[model samples]
Target: EPEVTQTPSHQVTQMGQEVILRCVPISNHLYFYWYRQILGQKVEFLVSFYNNEISEKSEIFDDQFSVERPDGSNFTLKIRSTKLEDSAMYFCASSVTSGEAFFGQGTRLTVV
Candidate 1:
């Protein structure tokens, strides 16, 4: 089965630095989203994108985070000015609708 794939499965960065996480969602899916889990806690929704524009975003997705569809197959998340609290397993998901999304294994971000 097709699945979302994220690169650099693990990343280590310094606080206040910037990092960009890359993802390639399922080919046929239209809606894309970014969600994060803090040390195995409940997954929190960050942002969603459709038709190349942001459809909805949670308050947690403030100025520090951004989502982009730079091409037909690539979806990306960029975090500027990283914070210690930002360390987590970031997942990329996609689906026909928001109801049942398929998630990637996730990229683990660690801030030092």
Candidate 2:
């Protein structure tokens, strides 16, 4: 079985700076997503992509946030200006069907 992989398992950045979190979803999966968990909070959906375009996004996914498939294999999430509130465990997930998703170990982003 294949799984999702994320880079820089942990990241620390200054507030008001830019950060790009990277991930490689299962090749056969058709849907990709970005989600974040603020410590003790529930997992929050940020965005979902399909067929190379964003299919859905949450209010938390503001203009400061963006996602791209880039070359079609690597999926990435870019935060234009980091905020303290953005600090959390960011997860990259993918699924053959939207019903079940496989998540990466996650990137722990700490914004100072």
What's the lDDT for all of these models? 0.95, 0.97
Count of steric clashes across candidates, in order: 0, 0
lDDT of 1 by residue, 1-112 (tens): 8989998799999999999999999999999999999995999999999999999999999999999999899999999999999999999999987589999999999999
User: Candidate 2 at residue 66, lDDT?
Assistant: 95
TM-score result, candidate 1: 0.96
lDDT of 2 by residue, 1-112 (tens): 7999999899999999999999999999999999999999999999999999999999999999999999878999999999999999999999999679999999999999
- Tally clashes: model 1: 0
Task: Please name the candidate that would achieve the greatest TM-score relative to the true structure.
Answer: 2
Please report, as a residue range, the 10-residue window in candidate 1 with the lowest summed lDDT. 96-105
Model 1, stretches more than 4 Å misplaced? none
